[model samples]
Target: MAVIHRAELRPTKLELLAAWLPGRRWYQGHADADVVRVAAYRFDDPAGAVGIETMLVSAGDGPVHQVPLTYRDAPLDGGDDWLIGTVEHSVLGQRWVYDACGDPVYVAALAGVILTGGGQAEEFLEVDGRLEPRETPTLVSGSGSEGADVPGISEILRVIEDDPTLVVTDSVQLAVVRRLDGGNRLPGAALTGTWNGQPNPMPLAYVSTR
Candidate 1:
């Protein structure tokens, strides 16, 4: 379960992304355009120290984007390459934010979800010193691993394409799909999850063995 804080965040999420999105190679919108958050989901970290979130946003009239982010109380080691920047949380103080792809905690949590039939983190909003169950507009579930010691590198598909290029071999297992088509079923997903409003399961990430 994940606790949702109703408190304020300095520089807000969108504000941070607005300044950073333009530099991303995969971002397809005008970086200066006002970004609108469309939907989001979360995955829980077992240790409860890291906050993992994936936000879907739209800049102006462009296509929706999937941005996975991880929040930490301290700076992540060797994460400057993927760091989105930092933010101040009213309840948690200073937080170090980074692209989820570079965080081991986020990667492991996602792998755990795929290996174990796990659902998206349950959200409870804190209100007036009380906790209230909040319904996530989008629900996600993962495909569990079969009884096998599968090892691979988990890859995030930055660009959504019509035909996803995935190659799963004895030494590699790839899962890739960004723009999900409800009609097409993903292949060789160690884990497959569905969005609440969509009829199909979207490939969360691809795991490739080394």
Candidate 2:
């Protein structure tokens, strides 16, 4: 399960994305337009140290974009190239945010979900020393079946940023769709999701063996 904190964030997630999105090669919207959060979902880090989130956002009335991020307490060694920026979390103190494509933990979790037909993590908010179930604004699921063998993914060999961000892992390759459209029927296990105005499931990411 993913734990939620009702704390404040300095230069909020949307603010950071607004500044970062335009620089992305695959960004299809105007650079000066305002970016708004559409919806989001989370994946759990088995070690419970890192926070993984996949956010959907839009610039003005432009096409929706998919951005997967990972939050950590400390800098990811040798990941300066993928660093998005830092933010202060009221409950977690300073956080080092990075593109999930460059984070090993996120890669492993995403691969596991796709290969095992898993879904997004269940979320519970921390409220005055108690846990309260929180309804997620988005829902996501993988296409593979339960008990499917998931290869161990420890490192990212390469990352190609494009309309579909391609991440080459130690044992497999992941294609993370940057722009949200109708689902893409790729030749691999895929992760699909649905959010607010989007009732039909759309492809978010795909996993294929090398």
Candidate 3:
């Protein structure tokens, strides 16, 4: 389970994404467009050291984008290229945020989820020293079944950003859907999700053998 804090964030997640999204080749919105959160989900880090969250956001009236992010207390070694920016957390202090495509932890977690038909992490909000179960705004599930073998992904060999972002690993290639405009028909073990407006499940990512 992932714990949620009531603390405030300086230069909120949307604020940071608004500045970074335009730089990506697949981004279809204007540079100064207003980015708004649509829905979000989380994956738990087994070691509980990193916070993994995937957010679905829309830029003005444009297409929704899937942006997976990881939060850490310190900088990721040799990950300067993927660093989105840092934010000050009222409870966690300073946080180093990076695009999840470049984080090895996220890659492994995502692979495991896709291969094992796992779902997003359960969330609990910390309030006055008590943990309260919180309902996730979005729900996601994988296509593979439980007990399926999941390969270990030690590194991200390459990240190609297009309509769908591809992360190349030693064992498999992960295709992360960038724009949530529908009509994604990739074959392989995949992850799909549903949000408020989007009641039907849509493809979020898929894993293909290398």
Candidate 4:
């Protein structure tokens, strides 16, 4: 396991969002919009290098969008724009804040971590070196694939939909639900996840990559 450094005494999950939400493409608002975190969860890349989270923030609109996030100690080599902004945790007492999903390190770690289980795997290479991956089903959900539930991962992937049937992989467990308002993708967002099974046993969303 790599030694991942995280600031201690981090802000409330909601407070983090107050600071983080304005920077997302999925986020709909002007430069000065108020964001309210409806809910959130925490997770770690399988390799433990990337700290991950999925948050559902309400822009005060009727729609709550899924905002997948990752956190890192340093700036991603190719992701200066994806970074929302960095801040020293008022509680954690450290500096250097960044959105992890924008970083190649987090995406690569997520890819490996997500497919941690199964007798088989569907390999995906990130697009443009971002997280935009060609997701082909490696193991159908319910294949008894097990992985570490790094706390808020389910909270992150969930909330986008309310489904009783959840999708599980070696790394992630997600539930297939359609985007109610047809959530839009980021301009730089480039990735796809494919589930290989008869009749497509998992819900695959059109996560567009520009």
Candidate 5:
């Protein structure tokens, strides 16, 4: 079937980020910036229920960053508590952007995967007003069979740029995998492409260490 769970050009979550990103630790500045939805793509889930969307939100803050986020169908236990916002779906008609990981069905599915892979689903949630990594609260599941492992940020990294995807997994994102082809340094673990067609995967940090 289609790999994307929910594929459509609907209203993006840009408006929400206008007030969210600046508050994040990763946000650069602009004090009060606005988010513009550029391009968005959804990943195909083994199931047909859960919603996993990858959005490219751009702010007027000079450079842009690819913010990959995961959305679910079920109502997250915490609602917008941890999520950006919740509202009726524009294209799907009426629904909310639930952070699937919060649902019990999804939790169970993730637990099942980890159980078989010798790992556990750790919910990196905000506790005491601070985002921290904690053990899975309970068993979680998905709305439908649309449950699958979330990809690390590295997947966005063009393999033609760096070496094998970096095994980095502590930051909730995968490192770039592919090959470097120039003298510049790669910025983050993931990069979109070169500005002037310099080198694709220049170096994330210094240059060639992979």
Candidate 6:
């Protein structure tokens, strides 16, 4: 399970993305356009040491983009290239945010989900002395094998593309959907998700190598 914190974040997520997204090679937003978060989902770290989230955002009415982020208490070694900048958390103090694709924890969690056909992480918020379920606007699931060797590398598709098929093999461990489309169709083994705007579950990405 993932805990939904009620703490504030200095600079805010959008504020950071607004400045960072324009510089990304895969960002499709107009240079001057404003961006907004459309949907999001999370995956739990079994050790509970990191926070992982996939944010679906849009600039104006343009295509939705996926930005997977990982939050940590300290800088990730050898992940300087993937750093998305850091933020000050009201409750957690300073946090280092990085592109989830480059984080080992995020990569492993994603691979495990695909291999086990697992669903998105369950979330709970602390209310007035009680733990209340937090509702997510999206539904996500993964499909793959559980008995294969874990892949050592993972590539994240940042730009949104219009492909409904995923090609995979035992040697190649994963294929991530760069952009999601209207069609609810997908080919071969993969991960799928459905949100408010897109009711039908569509392929999000693919994972293999157990």
What is the TM-score of each predicted model, taking all chains together? 0.79, 0.97, 0.98, 0.45, 0.44, 0.83
Candidate 3 residue-wise lDDT, 114-190, digit = tens: 88999999999999999999997698999999999888777789988776889998888998999998867788989
Provide the overall lDDT of each model, using Cα atoms, as 2-decimal numbers.
0.68, 0.92, 0.92, 0.40, 0.38, 0.74
Q: Give the TM-score of candidate 2.
A: 0.97
TM-score of 5: 0.44
Q: How badly does each model clash, as a count of residue pairs? A: 8, 0, 0, 15, 26, 2
* lDDT tens per residue, model 2, 1-210: 999999999989999999999999989889999998899999999999999999899998789999999999999998998899999999999999999999999999999999999999999999999999999769999999999998887678999988798999889999999988764567789999988898988999999988
Off by over 4 Å in 4: 1-25, 29-33, 90-92, 109-210
Q: What's the CA RMSD for each of the models?
A: 4.6, 1.0, 0.8, 14.1, 15.0, 4.3
Write the residue-wise lDDT of candidate 4 on 1-210 in tens digits. 222233343554556666666554344555455666554333445665555654555665545544556656666565565565555654334434455443444434343334433222233333443443343323322222267233233112222223212223333433322222433332211222222222323222222111
Encode model 6's per-residue lDDT on 1-210: one tens digit a residue.
988778899879988888887786657768778879888889999899999998888887667877778999999988897798999999789999987766767777777777677878999997766789998889888766556445554443342222322333333444555445443444446778889988877777765453
Which residue runs does candidate 5 get wrong by more than 4 Å? Answer: 1-12, 77-81, 91-93, 98-210
Q: Which clashing pairs does model 3 show?
A: none
Better of 4 and 6 by lDDT: 6
**Comparing 1 and 5 by TM-score, which wins?**
1
lDDT of 1 at 128: 92
Q: Tell me which of candidates 3 and 6 scores higher on lDDT.
A: 3
RMSD of 5: 15.0
lDDT (Cα) of model 6: 0.74
Give the better candidate number (2 or 6) by TM-score.
2
